[model samples]
Target: MTQLTVFGTLTTLSPFHMAHAGVSAEIDQNGRVRKLGTGTAKLPCTPTYKVPFPLSGDLAVGFDGTVRAIAEVPCLPGTSIRGKLRRVIAKRIKRHFIATGQLLSREAYHCIQCGAFSGDGIKANLTTSAEVIAADQQLFTGIFGGGPRLFRSNLRTHDSYLYCAETEATDVLPVIPETTALIRAYQATFAHPFIRRDDLLDFLDPIAPDVIENYAEAFESWQNTVLVTQERKALDRNAALEARAAKKRGEVVEKPEASAPTEKQKKVMLKGQSALEAVMPGVNFGFRIDIRGDDAQCGLVLAGIVDMIKEENFGGKCASGYGRMAAHLRVMNERQEEFPFLDYDGRKLLVGNQIKSYDDALESGLSQLTSASFEAIYNPKTEPSPRKGKKTDDHDDDEG
Candidate 1:
């Protein structure tokens, strides 16, 4: 007889032994130890004899292995390590592009109608769509070789698909509105490296004055959001600590005993649990925003979308519960927008509010406004995208 334990995400324990080699072992829903195997071979009493189990799934016995009694294996911690690694990788890739001055290119800004931006002072918007596609192609080929070629091809195809889908029957000559155009331009401009010089003034000269100011503003806004999230997490931790202290001191903390949870409470808890699981899959969630154009438009667009989703009941039901959900949104242009959303079953949820032209979104702040509109569009729906295929090498990693 052999005794072995299986550990995985499911809360059920399946025991296997030599006698039940072909049959499946029954496990309870709560994952508790239930029954032992029946196969037994009595031997002369020896002081050190113990049963050994092989780590491999194969049940066949071989002559060279020693027998030892099986013991419980410790459970592995889920996803925290993977999350850290993902953040590191995203940062590294961002830095590499910035250093190489390959984030933006002159060829990215050809005029759609006449290709007039070929000369100086003609005004141009960063071609974010093209730049991101190029950068991702470079990264995929550089790191993973031919494996990511299909992914790169898919992304290019998707971009073209989006372009056609979003722009069909629309004219291309209209000037994009100032606000939206600026956002796109900013994304393209900032992606470029700041040229180094002997003097501080010379170093600063390479960077556009407006670019520096805009980055500072965006950075400040990001900092404020991060601070608030940290403060909320701190408050939750403090409350938990206080509760533990009160229980230790024998203080009468008024609370309900373990009566049956109400239907609403049960639903909220279930949603919270699901959100937590969605945000942190078996691996850590990661995002990379590659701005091939002048500004981090896509990244900013995504951040704005995440903020709206967090506020409007996407992360379970309440703010406290939302904190427990632990979503990490990374912006990477080469791939489609990939992030875990409970509403989307942790799959890519494309909210296509395709405008006739970039000018339409620019004039109306389309990305920002439509982000909210799309939330309304998607909030009630639970269906996954049929377009979402199996996890390929090019698919962005998700945690949940």
Candidate 2:
């Protein structure tokens, strides 16, 4: 069980949002949906973390005469956290080469780190003549997995739940009554609702005069057809009702022919308004990461985590001032002995037990990462030529 575990609390410095691709609807007494709201992935995935409802069966009603249930709790999913870390690491590596003026070929770069962090597909037409390329491939695959040889990742991440005083520190989120109580308490606070405005139509300064005129004409056409469209809809509804009545009376009913949609119906208008849900600031999520590698491997993962933390953004909607979190990480051995991995005092990244400065640690980490093999593969003086061969017509070359 020789593993290095990094455990910490990530406090939200700004509103955090992780989109869950589903809708939550407000139910009425008759079980009919009154309204629908897009949900965020902040909800807990397991029943162990779900809030307990009282036996009284009393429920809260909304202003629109709809009943809403607050049975689930919110949490920061580890998959999203892992995805964000991987992206930052890949970006950091790319920026490092660009800053050093290496200017490696796109194919060569892809060959070096294909299927490492993001996907599990081998890039086509890569010629591995040099051992340096293979070594670099191993380095990346060993850390993140799924390179040419498909090495398993040495690091594992666990789902993170809201930090509660009663919960103990563990790699996997504990399934206990206290955890349920924590979920219950967190459900009480819930997510804050905010209206995201569509300002694209409001600002037209950059639009060309001709383009604006075209838009005006289109809008005018839509306006003129509005009354006609309403009348058509009403007529269609009446026809449908008559057809239903005729069927009920045992009379044969001929279905109407399908008509093509008109241009007015296809015209883009103002986007629909949606109330977005987001986790508020000042809430802390407990997270844990286990590394089954030596100091070098651990250091590399820590470097990426530190780089991502420096950006101070996670999950989604970061550009709109959401998902900013401040991390407080500490590394410990399997025996529970503290191992000085890295430290971030909200500004600088200090590494090792001695806590070296950010620059020094970065230099050391980069040196270990870029050894003789790496230099041989990415010689700055020699520009890598693009792979020569017939390009495949496969459009499935997505770098997932």
Candidate 3:
């Protein structure tokens, strides 16, 4: 199988944030806030070589060196890339092509609701859409993603990072008393070189019983790398939140609990936490794409990436200015030969063959997603009527 590596840096135009699953976030009986998860602090992800410096901020100076740490998204997940690129390409199709309403291909043949595309269509016996997507369409499956495959090389992403200097300033800027305390907390993991591997979990998975347990010591040596917050506005505290974004739409926005920082805790805030965590503009994090596939498949990926660079931003807080990055896509083969997709300035994909700069692909993509399939896919059953039966003359009606 042939492979190509496209590597570049995600130079943040703004701060990025992603709180992973294992992060410990809690408030004790003392009302002190402790948030443990910050993806950048993970032991497996930290880089081997680092040029440590103080947490660069007006407030970072207060925290003792032992606790000063920064949090980052660590790596840009492949799903994020796939999803965003899908949307970008889909949107372009919608913008220049698709009109008011058009239906799209539904899930898979296994569906009790839909079974048109697959060979065996019996609703009673289901063969999942996931299976078909993986087998039938390599463009949808092989290039971007689909179901898993054996003996196959597809696309993958590398993690990004935080470029924090030292963790000196502890005093949190724009100190908002309680709401900022959690950000004020710090979690540190051991960052030594011997135990770190960019793909640690990949090695640990499906635990090998036959092989001697060699990594136990290395795993035990792992510690919580520190997480420090620079002084920052309590976004939840001050914002009208309702006007901002109601998170789960239609749900009431929860208010931030009032936390009174103790003198000692206040010093931590004075040190940093509420201070900062976002990889502000001008910071650069590494990003790479590894593709192990054929030329046409590689072209599809390159096209999607070009759209991502020209029109999209990766990572969190893209709603604001954060996560926007410049990606230079280069195709590197096993022979160490590199071909820069420099022609793809990321503006648009050229339609080849019958479709020219003058000719266009007939795109049937659409915005009207809430159609008949909405109910078939997953629609909530309506609430039962308040009244079971019609009112009778004999029954007295309730006051209006």
| Best of the candidates, lDDT | 2
Among these predictions, the greatest TM-score belongs to: 2
lDDT of each: 0.26, 0.52, 0.39
Task: After the best TM-score superposition of candidate 1, give how far the Cα of residue 190 lies from its true spot, in angstroms.
Answer: 44
Q: Could you tell me every candidate's TM-score relative to the true structure?
A: 0.17, 0.57, 0.41
Assess candidate 1 and give its lDDT. 0.26
RMSD to truth, every model: 29.1, 11.2, 22.8
| Order by lDDT, highest first | 2, 3, 1
Give the per-residue lDDT digits (tens) of candidate 3, residues 60-177.
4434444343432243455566567666544543343235454443442122122123432232223357644443334323444321122122667554433222211432121112
How many clashes (backbone atoms < 3 Å, residues ≥3 apart in a chain or on different chains) does model 2 have? 0
- Tell me how far the alpha carbon of residue 268 in candidate 3 is from the true structure, in angstroms, after superposition: 19
Write down the TM-score for model 3: 0.41
Which digits, one per residue and each the tens of the lDDT, describe model 2 over residues 244-352? 5677789887984334434432221132222345666776677788876544455557777877788877767789887777766777776878755555555566656
Q: Against the true structure, candidate 3 has what lDDT? A: 0.39
lDDT of residue 4 for candidate 2:
71
> Residue-wise lDDT of candidate 1 within 143-223, one digit each (tens)?
111111121211110100001111212222112222221111001110111112322222344564456567656556755
lDDT of 2 at 126: 47
